[model samples]
Target chain A: MTVLGYLANGLVFSSIIVLGSIGLSLVYSIADFANFAHGDTMTIGAYTALVTFGAVGGLGGAVLGLPYGFFLALVVGIAVAAVVAVGTEKLIYEPLDVDSIGLLITSIGIAFIYRAVIQIRFGSDFTRFGIQSLRPIETLIPYGVRVTLHDVAIVASAVVLVAGLHVLLQYTDLGRKMRAMADNPDLARVSGIRTKRVKLWTWVIGAGLAGAGGVFLGLFNQLSPRMGFNLLLIIFAAVILGGIGSVYGAMAGGFLIGMITQLTPFFSNVVEALPIGQGWLATLLENLITLEYANAIAFVIMVVVLLVRPNGIAGEGAT
Target chain B: MSLLADPKAAFADLTRPERWVLGVSVAFMLFLLGALLTGALGPTYFLFLVGLAGMYALLSFGLNAQWGFTGLINFSVAAFFGIGAYGSALMTAESSPIAGGFNPLVGLVVALVVALVLALLIGIPTLRLRADYLAIASLGLAEVVRLVVLNERWLTNGSAGVRGIPSFFKGWPVLSTFPETMPGLRLVVIPGSPIILGTSFWEALLNVLLVLTFAGVTFLMLRRAHQSPWGRVLRTIRSDEDLARALGKNTYSFKMQSFILGSLIMALAGVFYTHLNLYVGPGDLDPITTFYAWVAVILGGSGSNRGALFGGIVIVTIREGTRFLNDFAIPIDPAPMRLLLIGIVIVAVMRYRPQGVLPPQRELIWPSAVDGGGTTETPDSGVREQKGGGGDE
Candidate 1:
């Protein structure tokens, strides 16, 4: 594929990653814990949509090659994911008396529970939505960019959700309270902000976005027991690269990381074409810059970022 | 000797909960012994279980050193374990892509050196950051290692895995042929169901001996280090890094040492596992193994060596018990059940008993300092108390 083809694919993949990173970053700031269950929360959303679509059926007409029922399934997926996160917080995280690291460990347990329950119900196999797959648009293929209408729909919906979030954060009362709590929970609570309520809302918004990301991811690829978990570290890399607590930074970081992951094959091709002498250096680059090492490349980038810029790219001050 | 004669007086120092734990452990061991004598559990399988427990104990020891003592959250436990397994497997397995037919002792050496280098590579970047950064980076390191193993077919044999691995005592003069040389024995323990001690049983006994050696040496080394001024410095770093730094301790260097030490122990467990299983695969490096060690350390009581050992045995029970349940009792799969059990244990432990079932309960001052003072100091005001609530930051 041409560079444009890879770029298009990156755009679609980045949309899902951006959706995931935003939730993780928000919770990290407001909830005050690196929730390991956030990825499983995405899995919850995807499976919920899978069951919803199977139950609801086509519901008549279609748009962008997806049935109306799929959209309904998407909404249901988001709602269920939000409800589950809230339930876990109320029943587990709230009553517990431990520091953030303790909560972090607890979150791993939560992640396992979510995944095990899913595996019990669904079995450890891959499945897809009832919606039929679509082919790349003919006009785009001629221009060396091949993306189906489904991919466009995913990107468009992500943009709409992200824009909605931007307006909410910049203008709305709840968003302001969330931002305030993210900045300093004690100050916000002292200033009459109901921190608990804000925290609950953060779970809702973060998990809700993650749910949408999960739905899009299932549509982009096949849904499996490990689908969300497999993507989790990459999402974490995105969140960290953007600064853990910053939502806007998460978007940029998600985009860059997602692009790099998808463009690894193209990068390898470029390396093969480069005339940078014939020695161990050339051989090393050729061996390392392959598609199989795509995720490894992202992880390496994350470690490097941790070393040079521990606070992340958009972090305001030293942590 | 007096305590053995008067059990009640021996138990006087232990708390009520500690006494209960001790009673339950004794009862459980007796039950297992009864089952073995009845010929219900095969001797070979029983010996294998012991070796598995010892291996897990070694893994837990490694994590205890890093997470328990030094407060470094190294999430790449499985990576070190996998590197150890792969390191040894590549050196000794017939199907190894690079080189094979090497001595198992050489494999052990290579595994430790590789683990040491990898530890330094990963620790140097994240140890300087906040505690959580180490957690994140180490997790990434695990994934990277797993991917490399899975993709680099030429180096690791990819998903096909390395097989034809010899036993741990492959090169030993007498031990190499000991299993074959020894005559098989059969005891009619239960009339029709005689307890058989065949070649496999002898081989398993040898594996158990090997693991015991590894775990025993690791335990002694850790005990000595953990009770010294050096371990006191690490505990201080765990509870309060600034305090240790203020006292002119180089916390970074101490953390690196702890990280490397723990990683080496985990690698040692891996080397043992490769010999025990006689094969190594990329799937062996799954993140589940890392969490298994985490569960072992936290549930066993962080910073407590005996607790880690207890936790390791408990983990093996949970792991093997689920398989046993699936085989005979229920039709349900064991994998999800094990995950659920692990999940519940973690959440319950955090919620109810965050200090764990057997938290460390002794002071860590230098033995010489206390001996020279010649004053009886209360053990109550020990490392756990100084650790305050929530052992980790």
Candidate 2:
């Protein structure tokens, strides 16, 4: 594969991570606790999309005269995830006032409950969107790199969603309130920013994006109960790698993580493709660093970044 | 230190009645578990469950040392445990395609060393971050460990996993022979013909002994450590890093020491777990294992070592006790339901009793009444603040 192919692939991977990490970062900033269940929420989102797609079958974009009904499914998926996030906050988080380690542990409990629920409900079966017949529109690049419609959709939607969030944070009153609350909730409350309302919106937007990210991830890969759970560590890696509270850091971290994770397998390939007379380099690479270690690469980066700058690239200082 | 400085002040805080209450409650719980383990059908099956609970208790003790005493959140419990399990198994597993076949004792030492190194590697960079970031970073580290276990086929035997690990007491004569002829064994030395006194019984007894040795040693060590000046320093660091630093304490080094100690204990527990099962698999070291230990810590009471043990026993009972339900052919699979219930229990514990079943006792041993200085130690301020910080939520 050409370098462009890898870049396109990286973008596709980054798009989903970006969506998830944005929510993760936002929640971290506003809630001041890591939502361990965020990844499971993404899984829930994907399943919600799957359920919606089935329920709204073969209806084929007739309502909006679009190419696919998956878009509508995506909306439902987001709503479902948002409801879950909001409901959890109302029931568990709000009442608990999760400012302590208690909240962090509670999130872990929620993660387990959510993941187990998905398992019990879905029977641990690997499901897919099953719209493979709607094949990706392949585009042949000058170097014979193949980019597809699905990849384009993922990258395009990610761009649009991130851009939309950027505008909201930059221009809107609610976004400003959210930022203020994240910066200093007491100050925001004293300043009459209605911190509670901002928190509500934070969950809404964060979970909604996570839902969409889940759908995109399902489209890109297999849909298992573990799909989101597996991605969760990487999502965290991205969030922390970018710095906990920064929106832009999440974006940059997501892209870097995605690219690194996607490209790590190619290290072995690069070694093999080298014109070295000795095979030891490739052999060593193959043995020491296989494709399965892709996830580890993200973590290595996260740890390195954390060691160098605990606040993250965009973070001002430790929270 | 003043002669009146009661180092075990926290332990001494228990009134006579309170001590009796705790003792009786613990005795009752242990009696039930012991009965279950020694029953007609208990020797083989229930022993496994009891053994597992012991391991969980040990893991919780380690966690209690970290989170309970030091206020460090370690999501990498499973990774450390796995490191211990795999480290020992690789050394002791009988002639595998992969792994170094070393002595089991050496394996245990190696595993502890590995865990200590790993804790240092992970803790050095991330411990300086806020609590939540440490949690996330540890979670990532665990995943990285899992990935290594999964991908490194030559070392970990890949997902196929290293198997047939020799039990810690593999060929001990007492374990393999009839207890009647057993030479001067303590259990046999007792003036009673125990009904379940046989080879199998001896094997189970030895396994139980191994777990007890580890658990007892861990509890004592942790209790001693927590009561020491070092433990007091850790508590201070947890409560207020800035204050601890201002006091000229190397807070980072203290925190690292706490982390490494806790991780070593966890790895030791893992070694016990491996030998008990007599097999090692990649599947054994998932996030769920870590979560289970966390649940134990939470349920028992986070900061208290005894609470950790109680929590571990309770959780293991629930988990293993529910297996009988499966035999009765329930409408739904009880496995996932058990987990769901555990999750609910965790949330309930967090929301209702964030301080846990037994709140951490104030560390200040107030100067004795006749000491002419009945004032609390200066460290009491930090302890008070630590307790106050538990539920600012």
Candidate 3:
């Protein structure tokens, strides 16, 4: 039961990583800039969700009395996504016009500006939305198997988002244009496609997904001004490990990273049974590795995978 | 065709009287230092600042040889610096099973050897991929190193840090021999009468000798290297990689060498850092430390060895000065203003004079040489140079 509980927890965590990184890949593909602000886009969404839910009287006043906090998160998430989408294109991405070095420098500037603004306003401390909503269901599972309603939201939302992405890319005319442009912008432009429109639509959907992922993440963890900044490294590793521009690769990379992190403690328990048993290794990790640093576990996975396969598991163009 | 092909013309041009002014400037500095010692200023604190700046200049020289010469953006300076400090600490001190069942001297040697191996480890994999991947990977690697340092308390003493190091240059003894705590003087606050970073006279004396030895070696080696054919290849690679490749050079190996060498130099600085503080902590090597090096190199003019030294002095002075200046009844908030000023300097230099001050591989040609081709092959070749990192392919 504990293993299963761990698996559930892993999946919940993986869903957020996958979602966050997939946006990274999309923006990288479209804008051709490593948007350092992509993670902050998540912060913006999380903060917006909090504000939106507050306006809606805490998501519990609805008829079903179901976990409506997530429902509120969706609306606010989309709105934040739309705002950043239009804003970045108008204010940041479009103005830069795909110069790699310029884009890189400007994105760094954008990140600092975003961080400074967030800090000035939010005061650099962790704030949490209530988690009492998940307490009762967590106690009922055997193997002491525990799952929060927030975990349920993350897993369920991830499935819905991934499916929606797959269908959108496969079935829609807009996705068709985006894929065409991603393949070759010159050819797409020559083929009479409106690349700018496709890019705008891409950012809207991509950043909206980032926003939803942020809300899911913030619900599980606490929200701080620099909350998503550290997580960006792990997310980038996932994106690269998955493949630079692939969505599904990001998903696989995320879950792989998630399981590796959870399984470290699992390894310690297994080793404790050995003859030279040093429970010290596990206890040392617990004492020394801060929760903030747990995010970097994904980078090791990424560096290893990147060295082995720069093209990623799905290969190029396939993502 | 003129100066570009003739090394004699460039060497002869440096013999002029006005050019001697730059040489005389060094001598002038020596005289001024001599005066400041006996004069009203005393120059104790200023000398300390200069010593620290000289150490940083060596660090900047290493970085300049890497980034200025090789065109790499090493975002991992702090990690390498920490590695060096830990290396130095372990080498010069005594340790027991208390620190991972191994001695620090053994760890120090192991650390330096692994550093070169680590550079190759980081370089070979990422070098074949995008350059930015190296930047990202290196940043990630720094976090891993920091985490390992923190977690392996068995090795690093964990976040509380390792302390009680035997000082290599402990203190100056001769100049500070007059003990104020002696019954004759009665000058002691309590006893022993401490001065010079609050170290005993012997420790300060030792530090001066050690700092001078390290500084002398760095200054000479960098000067010798600057004039070598290898340095010429580096300048060419920085200007245009493909052109260098077209000239029958393998750019990658040189880049790898520069990276490892630069990292080793930073490691040396790290050793001094650990000994100076008598401790090693994870938080000591932050990104700000790396940027300080960048500021030094840029402020000093990227390719100039002497410029790096001067730049280090200027930047440290600005940083320390602004902090000290906060004590006055100033009406301005210099915190954000200072950051904005630094940012502007970066942007301004990049826009106007990207070759930086004291541009290396000095060959006087019109702007046309900035493009390798004649007027005939105008359009496509020009486009290629910009997009393709000026490979001349």
Candidate 4:
């Protein structure tokens, strides 16, 4: 595939990653823990949409190859994911006396519980939505960019949601409160910002975005028990790359990580064509820069980022 | 040794909850022993369970050293374990892509050396950062290692896995052939059931012995380290890194040492597992194994060695018990059930007893330094301080 083709794919994938990373970063800042369950929350959203779409079916006309029912299912998925996160916070995380690290570990357990329950209900198999798959647009195919209408739908929806979020954060009362809480919870609490309520809102927005991401991800690929989990490390890399706790940073980080992951094969091809010296270095690059190592490449990039810029690309200077 | 010599005194030393744990553990062991004698469980399989328990204990010991003793969240326990397993398997297995048919001892040495190098590679970058950075980076790096093992067929045999692995005592003279040479015995433990002891049983006995040696040596070394000034420094670092540094101690080096030590122990567990199972595969490098060790260490009491041992046994029980339930009782799959149980255990432990079931109770001051100071009573103030202060990010 050409660079444009890879870039188009990256754009579609990055939409889902951006959705997932925003929630994770928001929760990390406000909740004060690296929630290992955030990915599973995405899984919950995906599976909920799967069941919802299965039950509701196509209601009428289709836009971008997805039925109106899918849009309905998407809303339900988002609501369910948000509700679950809030419930877990109230029932488990709120009463716990442990610190952020303890909450971090507890989140792992929550991740497992979310996954296990889904596995029990779904039987660990991969499935797709009732919507039919669409072929790449003919005009785009000729230009070496082969994104389908569904891909366009995903990206367009993501852009709308992100824009809505931007407006909410920048202009709305809840947004201001959330930003304040993320910056300094103690200060926000002292200033009568109602940190608990803001935190609940954060869970709602973060997990709702994650749920939407999960639904789009299922549309993009296929839904399995491990679909969200498999993508989790990449999402984390994005969050870390953008600077943990920064919402806008997560968006940029998600875009870059997603692009790098999809463009790995192209990079390897470029390496093979380049007139680099024919030695072990060349051979190693050729061997390591394959599709199989795409995720590994993202992980390696995350480690390097952690090494050089621990606070992330857009984060404030290191303490 | 002191506990064995003065049972009454040791019993008096235990907290009420610890006493309950001991009683339940003893009852459980006696029940298993009863089942063994009645031919309800196969001796070989029973011995294999013991070996698995020991292996998990070793893994827990490794995590305890890092997370418990030093407050370093090294999330790549399974990576080091996989490295050790693959390192040994690639050297000793007949189907190894690089080299094969080497002595098991050489495989052992190779596994440890490779683990050492990998530990240093992973530790150098993340150990200098915040505690959670190690957690995140190690997890990501572990995925990289798993991907490499899964994709690099020439180096690791890929998903087909290294096969035809010999036993740990493959070339140990009499021990190598002892399983085969031993005569089979049949004992009518019950009227209709005949308990048989054969070659497999002897082999399992040998494996149990091998695991016991590994766990025993690791236990001794950790005990010595945990009591020494080195361990005290680590504990101090765990509670308050600034305090340790203020006292002119290099916290980074201490963290690195603890990280390497824990990783080495995890690798040792993996080496034992490779021999015990006689196979190594990409699936073995699953993050589940890392979480299993984490669950074991945390459930057993973070800084307590005996708790780790107990936790290891409990893990085996939970692991095998779920399978047993699936086969004989419920038709539900054991996989999700196990995950659910682990999840509940973690949440419950954190909710009710975050310090674990058997938290380290005694102070960790050096014996010689305190002997002449006339402080005979070992107060657990350090442990209390750790519980309060260790979670500082």
Candidate 5:
């Protein structure tokens, strides 16, 4: 309703992309494909949270506290999503071992399987995290901008996860291996870096992030089979616009693209409600752009970024 | 040894592998042809499904040209197909606030031209990128096209879709008056049968014929093109653009040509599809359409035109045949299961035989010796290399 609401919404939306794009950029850097199914993997993670809550609701509520139970669900979601991601790589992608294009096609197949399985099990209906039960705490920021507790939780978790990732990449041996592999798989192998192990870890970290991102996204709005697929283009835009395979770039691009996507529609609505009683301009603006153009906006941004800098803003070159 | 050394016998000699290949191919073709003929004869629904399969075959053929031959990953097959369907439907629909009310022939021309132009526009800027980037960009482009169709009510009637577009040969005197003017032509294959030649039946028959004609023409043209110098250049680029460029070829121009040609063919499929259904909708242009064609191309073999056709029919049959799942007493909905199976099939195909049912064949050039002294590496191997390294200058 208010411009601040849109700003808050944009930050929440950008955090999800930030979380999701890290895994995507990681996998793209190391595995050498876009992993078209990454979005669906995020969906699976969100569904994991749903299943977790359903199974442990009584025990978690009775034993651990409410917040702890919810936290437990998020952890379980991250674990299950990681396993599924690794399993897909082993069963489908690793065996092919062809090229990026082959892997891309294989990922598409995996995406279809993931989507269809979710639809079959869940019946394609919209589900939610019962955020209402939380009776979310709202606080007013500067300029009277209201923010909810759910938004705070999502943003906080994203910050923690991203920082953790940054520490891992900068300091850990496994993270160094991943970076080396991403830089040059052949050279990494020649240097006896155990590329396979790095790849395994890549999926674990990437898919785990996807799962957390999915849960946050579901919390932000609703959960459905289409949730991840719908946001796939935007996630892709963020990944590419930031520079493929660059973690920090993915984060920056995610926020930039997310703000643009959400804020464009918000601005459009605001302008349309203005007291300028001109009918034709409103009609023209409505036709030229609408909220549904969110996907288009992402796409256009990605294309423009690619045209200007083929490797993306952060990319050194093709990974 | 004496029998093997006989010069006269050697003239007709065939390798054991060659004979096996011939036998298996012929048998497969016969089986498919038999299945199609029998199904068409048995039920009216059979004709529709079979015709639809033929249309898919055409779609795969177009994809085969791009991915199979040119090593281009096109995620916009559905967009081009949509262009074909909507282009024709908008032009030929009876004059309304939104439609042009032109003849279907004009619609066909417009569809081809639109497809060509769009392909050029999308390809020119993006084709030089890496294969994965192109895939990403094309995927975005497809969504853009579908979104445009969904939102532009003034042009595409929004999401409700255009309906009741005139079918092919609607109100044509030759077809409408066929029963009276050509009594002999009305003879049914089933002698003395009570089945009367109805207008719907004729339309179905004509559609089948039309699809077959398009498939046949597309297959022949593609085969010829691939065998020509132009096709060879495409293969060279697909294999290694650097090599092609070093050889003094303008690889960009060639890639563009391949892209546009494949798109033109895909658009043709879309035109026939609209006439067959007599409707066009944004739903018809989803990513799933592109996926279906990709399955066909992958299953059949990417570079082989015949393989593309084979893959199309097999994929379509699997798709249509799954409708029988309704008869089973499954607790859950069968629709999702069908898609799940298709997904598995694509994964399985990629894993076990990435080359497809038939590995793309090299141009057979007979020489004085069985092993030709050729210095050039085969295109199939080149296309299959680690393409991840591509897209960088």
Candidate 6:
């Protein structure tokens, strides 16, 4: 692939990776334990979209139009995520102390519980979007390459969501209080920030964003229980590689990882016939390995970042 | 230092009660197990479950070295376990084209070295990240490792995962002890034995031997280390990193040492896993297994070695026990329901007795007054703030 195509692919990949990581980054830097249930939230979001599409209802009769169904499904997905985010806090994670390792372990336990419950409700089948993995966009300004509507929406939505988050954090009262608490708990409390209310908003908003991301993901690709679970690593890698607490860093990291993923496939073609390329090397890798799974590429990126900067991207800014 | 000031001294007091509880529970479990053996489960079936619990418990103990001992909360225990199993299997498997190229002893040594190096390579960069970052990186690496195994077809045979491993130690002692017959469940033995040890005494024997050795090693090292100045410094680091550093200790180095040492042991555990099943694969390397090991460390008491053993056994036993109890206890399909039991156990463990069966106190004598609770040492402060922080950790 040429450099331009690579850049384009990176942008496409970045949109998804950043889209996923932003919600997690928002929650983690500002939130506490890493949420394992985040994956299921994505799964639930995809299912909401599926149901709205009336794909399951195809067995009977399709009543809801695609656009209307999509909008309604979006609302349902967001609502479900919001409720789960809040409910998990109240029912499972809240009662226990989770500031440190203990809370982290508890989070893992709770995450498993959430996963199990979801598994019971939704069996282990992959849910395919009625649309193709990369549905062609209207191509308002065609550059010879076809941009999938899914890709376009992801890029468009990601831009809006990130800009919205920045504005919310800078301009909103809730954002101010969240930063205050993040800086110093006692001070935030002493300042009468109503930390609880602010936190509730943070999770509802963060989870809602994740729900939207999930829908976006399903539009572009097949949905499975493993979708979010698999992407979580890359999302985290993006967050860390960019800078843990820095949302913008996550966006940058996401794109970088996405490009690397696509580029590996590009790199392999050259190796198959290139002079000086070891026959064994190409042959050894050809049968089992491909790096399109962004998470796999993310792992390599994470190792380098960690070795170079243990504090994560943005270093001290991560906290 | 005051005896209790030394966690080991305080821990010694608790070991007796610790042994008593696991002893009684395991004994009663064994009796019921015998009933399982003679009854519908028959001879070969019970051995399989016992072995699975033993191997899983052993892996958990290896993880406890980090979470239970040094307080790092390593989450990729299964990844390392898988690495060890696969590493050794690659060396000894009958199908391996590379097997005959080297001496068996050399092959085993090379495998161990390879696994050890892999652990260090993965651990060196990631282990210093602290808390969630470390957890994230390890989780990422585990997937990466699995992907590497999956993608490297020539090396790992791709998704088929290298098979036809020569069963290590299966020939030792009486072959019958391994159980010549699992009857209908024989299919489970080679792929991932689930029935034979579930019926046999051999599983219990292996647990006793391995756990005893682990216990011996743990007892001696923990005793001397807890008393030694370095040990005190290590504990200090766990309690408060700033305080330890203020006192002139390099908390970073201590953490690194503990992490590497603990991870190396986890690799050894992988070796045990491979030998048991005579196979290894991506499915075996799932993250859920890692989470279960964390559950073991918590149940064992985070800071105490004996607590780790008891907790590891209990965790494994509970996993199998619930399955066993569900055999006749519940009328519904149990596969989906089993995790619910795990979820409940975790919730209960988190709430009423977050400290676990063994409290974190140390003792001066072998038989001491206190019982060590796994996960007792750390304050619940972080978790209490989880909800306040939003949701996802």
Pick the DockQ winner. 4
Candidate 6 chain A, poorest ten consecutive residues by summed lDDT: A56-65
Question: B1-393, model 2: which lDDT tens digit per residue?
Answer: 532577476446664534754786779667765654445344446667778889999999988888888889889999999999988888888756555566678888988888888888888877887787788778888888888888877678888888888777654555434333544332322235333445555556677888999999988888778876787888888788889899999988888888888899999999998888887788878988888888888877767887788788877866865665666656446667667878898899888877677655543332232243434544433433565674354
> Candidate 1 chain A, which ten residues in sequence have the lowest lDDT sum?
A310-319
Query: Candidate 3: misplaced stretches above 4 Å?
Result: A48-102, A130-133, A136-140, A196-203, A270-297, B1-57, B91-114, B165-168, B171-220, B223-227, B239-248, B291-393
Query: TM-score for the first chain of model 1?
Result: 0.98
- Residue by residue across A1-319, what tens digits does model 2's lDDT show? 7676777778889999999999999998898888889999999899999998888875644322224678888889999999999999999999994465778889888987988898888877788885753443444666645656667777888898999999999899998888888788899999988788889899999999999999989988878888888999899889878888898889888888888888776676776777775667656666656678788878877877777887788767222
Where does candidate 6 chain B have its weakest 10-residue lDDT segment?
B363-372
Supply the global lDDT for candidate 4. 0.91
Of candidate 1 chain B, the 10-residue stretch with the lowest lDDT total is B367-376
lDDT for model 3: 0.65
Q: What are the per-residue Cα lDDT tens digits for candidate 3 across A268-309?
A: 455454465457775555543444356556677677777888
Candidate 1, lDDT over the whole model:
0.91
TM-score for all models, in order of appearance: 0.95, 0.86, 0.74, 0.95, 0.87, 0.80
Q: How would you class the docking of model 2?
A: medium
lDDT scores of the candidates, listed in order? 0.91, 0.80, 0.65, 0.91, 0.81, 0.65
CA shift at A80, candidate 4, in angstroms? 0.3
For model 3 the local lDDT of residue B82 reads: 80
3 against 4, candidate with superior DockQ: 4
Give per-residue CA lDDT, model 5, range B82-114, as digits (tens): 999999898887632365677778889999999
Model 3 error, position B268 (Å): 2.1
Docking quality class, candidate 3: incorrect
Model 6 quality (TM-score)? 0.80
Candidate 5 structure, TM-score to reference: 0.87
Q: How many residue pairs clash in each candidate?
A: 0, 2, 17, 0, 1, 51
In candidate 2, which residue ranges exceed 4 Å CA deviation? A62-67, A133-143, A271-288, A315-319, B1-41, B98-102, B171-198, B362-393
Over the stretch B1-393, how does candidate 4's per-residue lDDT look in tens digits?
547677887788668978999999999989998998888788899999999999999999999999989999988998999999999999999988998999999999999999999999999988987877778889999999999999999899899998899999999989999999999999886777888999999999999999999999999899889987799999999999999999999999999999999999999999999999999999999998999999999998998898899899989998999999999999778999889889998999999999998888653544323443333455544443465574444
Candidate 4's displacement at residue B82, Å, is: 0.3
